[model samples]
Target: MNKVELVYRELLFQALEKNNFLLTQKELSNLLSMSLSTVNLSLKPLRRMNAIKVNPMNLKTINPRKVLLYWASVRNLNKDIAYQTRVDVSISEIEKNIPANCIFGAYSAYKFRFKEVPADYSEVYVYADSLDEIKKRFPSKSGQPNLFVILKDVNMGRYGKITSLAQTFVDIWNLGEWYSSDFIKALEMRINGILE
Candidate 1:
């Protein structure tokens, strides 16, 4: 993921998870290790969409859904795929076999985050810093991919276990599966509940 997406992730995480919608550019820069200009650039769309109020001292998120959809629109989840393999095992077994260091994404992310599956899903996606363990476990197969390992960003560690709400939303938005829409609808309801 790019630095701009990282800013959206942090901002959404704060607003949705932490219940803190206001932050200064310097604080965001420090949290994501980005420059002030980069953080400023990331906020431009939010500002234009009237999703945030950017005062001199701080920025307040007024519409997190707008921010989320903006990120989802710009997110390139496919480009972040670091490794892909056909894990023929059941989805549960495949999830269990994932490396401990990985952060679950896509279908598995919705299950982990919400403790329920919106619909039956066939694939598992994860973000991992290294693929050695996954490679050893899943190996290679000849069929279509059921497991995808996304390249983990340096700042991803801030969200433990599963990917953050924004990350999960954007990732699911990029998927083509029919059940992916189910997950997206469930997530939107959940996010609306949180941000309400």
Candidate 2:
């Protein structure tokens, strides 16, 4: 990289040395005290060199080790970006293994068909068809995005874990006479997993 390119790379790397892996282009520009265009121009070469992969969204990530190296080379700043990267990877794995489509709602169903699941069962459940669907549907999870995938099709969003309380009730009511009474009762129990 050229002198200007290296300098800008250092600036970008320095800002990401901390635990905050989600750095925006605007934030990087602000921290580097350089124009956004300058920052973007400077970053272009490093990215071309395979040092960084830009995801121009609310949450952007890069290779922490390379970033820290650039930081040290330019500003003599040493930081362990590996730890943050590890955490991000680990969190991603955990979010990938949840189930899809179950436990939507049960308000009227609760009072009429299955009055077993207490009001505490008020949370609405969100599920998906697959993991790729999640990344495709919601690229970056921003503030209160209200959507999370325990793994692919399995999700916890809107209300997190459960969707709106209202939806949960509606689903239960709709399935009232469809499934067996014992089955619905079993669902009220945390252990009853039909998907399993």
Among all windows of 10 consecutive residues in model 2, the one with the lowest summed lDDT is 77-86
- The number of residue pairs in model 2 that clash at the backbone is 18
Off by over 4 Å in 2: 1-17, 70-196
* Model 1: ten consecutive residues of lowest lDDT: 187-196
lDDT of each: 0.91, 0.38
For model 1, state the Cα shift of residue 128 in Å: 0.4
What is residue 75's positional error in candidate 2, in angstroms? Answer: 7.5
TM-score per prediction, in order, is 0.97, 0.28
Per-residue accuracy of model 1 over 1-196 as CA lDDT, tens digit each: 8999999999999999999998999999999988999999999989999999999999999998899999999998888898898977899999988889999988898898778988999999999989898899989787999999987889998899899988899999999998889999999889888876
Compared with the true structure, model 2 gives a TM-score of: 0.28
The lDDT leader among the candidates is 1
Judging by TM-score against the true structure, name the best candidate: 1
